[model samples]
Target: DVRTTFKRMAMNDEETVALTAGGHTVGKCHGNGDASILGPKPEEADVEEQGFGWKNTQGKGHSEDTVSSGLEGAWSSKPDRWNHTYFHLLLNHEWESVKSPAGAWQWEPINMKEEDKPLDAHIPGVRRNPIMTDADMALKMDPEYRKISERFHNDPEYFGEVFARAWFKLTHRDLGPKSRYLGPDVPKEDLIWQDPLPTVDYTLSEVEIEDLKKKLLNSGLSQTELINTAWDSARTFRGSDYRGGANGARIRLAPQKDWVGNEPERLQKVLAKLEEIQQGLDKKVSIADLIVLGGSAAIEKAAENAGVKIKVPFSPGRGDATDEMTDAESFNDLEPIHDGFRNWVKKDYVVKPEELLLDRTQLMGLTAPEMTVLMGGMRVLGTNHGGAKHGVFTDKVGALTNDFFVNLTDMSYDWKPASDSHYNIVERKTGETKWTATRVDLVFGSNSILRSYAEVYAQDDNKEKFVKDFVKAWVKVMDADRFDVKK
Candidate 1:
């Protein structure tokens, strides 16, 4: 059996050596000599045998001496390796050497000359030209105009009107009238009614003419009264003037006012119905817990009256040091405390403070006292570990050598345990002939851990009692669990 053993040694900084034995030395030993480790040459080795060619000349050099110095040095000094340089030159040479399958050089016809080759034997009417026809060029340049022409081609009347307008504009002429400057001319009326006919000679009864005058006067009075009315009774009766002058002269009555005479009763009724619907919705859905009424002194006072807990950072004179509310002092005070809460709300509840606080209470069961303790613990822990060096362990056997554990000496002096009570143990075990190993591990209190535990408890079916019990346990651990207390 090929038995093996491991061990860890404790030494000062000056001692620096690693020793291991028992495995067979598998390959040729070089000791400390560098000669046999030299690499291979280029020319002496067969280009085909070594699979090195012009195409695969990634490590080949331009100069013979460079190539003879072996693959690495040759590749380092090679100029062909520069991007696109060798590729373009190689492609150009390959293209020049390539031949057509027809196997003979042939010239294309320049027009239909007899001396020149007949138009390409393979393709007929495949002429090459430098310029296109005017219509083709126009279609290529103005595709939208081609589309419009195709769309209106079937409508002769529309096409005719457009064509006529274009023709008139281009010729600077009008088709409507032939008169100069196209103005209207009035016609003179004939004077045929100038001569009066002879009278009938029979006279009308006096009472009949008098009654006719009275009837005509009464009709004019009725017409004037209809026109003078405020409501435009004539315009309303006349269908031709239905929309004419109706907008400006229109009089729409406003709905009657409510008791306060502020808002109309119709508007108030709509608002009252909406409010009732909202109240009904409120009964089914819950409002957020822990509503933070920032800048709302009135709402804050209302909350106090309602016996809800409120958290204010700090104030100067309230009575107790804890009771006194204080303004945020620096980024340190604001960042991990205020900003941390803000970030928590943003990430979890999208920065809605009420939702954030609600989630904080619901998901973590974070009561005022519980939150204060967790925040204070996080502050203390952050200050301690912000600059401390982390511990290291060995690879294969999962043991920590004294070299790796040396940082622990200063760690005990720098690490401030969040709690007061803790313990540690070191164990060593015997291995194969003349070998031993030692292992070390540490455990400590953390706000993240407690919060995670609280969240799990809060999400349980029996959450109220579970959260209460979890909070008690978390407080006990925070107050008592301890590791080394750094000065």
Candidate 2:
């Protein structure tokens, strides 16, 4: 039978997907001989041939008890290892659909050479791996599935916990009862929220949060501007910041706090908000964590309160920085010389696009999808500051969405920067052409790898995917260096 249990529970595409994707982490498919005209079967092909192998499991020899689900090939870097690599691989790369030897639909890497394939951990007797099936592809296409999968993709530890919980529930359904295995139940009253406790609270006060919103809006900065300013602060750290206790929010130290690239005003606003909050409550939370959370959380909250349809997730566990680590020299190397948008204003083309991208990729330590989402977000919100006109969100003013990438890449409305010094990407046709694609923004379309993702977000059917991707990226940037983050 099919995954009747999974479908019956109305499990979202992600949970079902994680299971299948994770399940395939260690198995191989049973491919038919070259029966159809599609291509050679796995055994018929050369040892290093790179492509996907698929088959239909509904035929004569197939049995209901075999859990093939019509997919086969390596799902893991080492097809025999059980890990989160499958989710990472799918999220990080573009896959093309193809017909298998058995005339089944499946997805495989397009034009991938042997050396170009991702390296899996070496296993004792394993040979090779191939691709995902159409059902497997749904995990990436379905908004909910893709979003959930990012949890696993971003943090393998978290994935393991979620999978363990899910697997336990799925396999233990028939076992007994409300209290038997979980533990003796505590009093129900233990779950109630305590009210009006002493204000030893460290988090931002409601008034500070509200007032910061006013400043960010009044300052005329876009969402990307605010988020990028905040994200950029923590984006640096040559791996040393996380080792000793020295890392926290040292960005708040005097010289470090005042450094030119800190965009001092951005964090100043965050600090002002925190200071405003400190006057009222004795906060237990550090100024560092608040700054990180303030970017995405505060912005989204203002939008939500005002009735804009944007939602972002936030968590607080960041520790504060000591003044000793905040030397002027300590903050020097943190400013980025280039990113997916520009090397510097008017300097995007100074270096080859790939070289510029490589510099950014290494600097931010972002995966391909993460980088794409960040680029789209920054471009859309006009957050790049130097090139304010080069984003789709610039025209909309303050709604957070993927229309920036869509508008930049859309074929229907021709988007071009204004000829004047305004730096705006204008629409030749109707709806208020206030956007512009800067050198960096243009690369998302020009670069082969970047364009695939840009095109995906541009499609009408993929709007949800775009939203989830942006939110995920926002969270990643905010959480990148926060110590004590949960798995």
TM, every model:
0.12, 0.48
**Candidate 1 per-residue C-alpha lDDT over 1-487 given as tens digits, one digit per residue, 9 for 90 to 100:** 0011111111111110001000000111111112223234455546654744322232232321122212110000112222111111211121112111222221111232232111221235432211112222222234543343333333434544544433332232212112112335321321111111112223224453333223322332221121112111001111211111111111111111121111234333333332343355422211100000011112122223323333222111101111011111110111111122211211222343333333433323345445433322222122111111122222211111122222222223233332222222222232212111111112111235443533343242532333234234232222110111111
* Regions of candidate 2 where Cα sits further than 4 Å from its true position: 1-226, 237-247, 302-311, 326-330, 339-354, 413-434
lDDT of each candidate versus the true structure: 0.22, 0.54
Per-prediction count of colliding residue pairs?
A: 5, 12
Q: Which candidate is the best by lDDT?
A: 2
Off by over 4 Å in 1: 1-338, 344-369, 372-452, 455-459, 465-487
Residue 74 lDDT (model 2): 54
Model 2, residue 436: displacement in angstroms? 2.7
Look at candidate 1 and tell me the lDDT of residue 17. Answer: 8
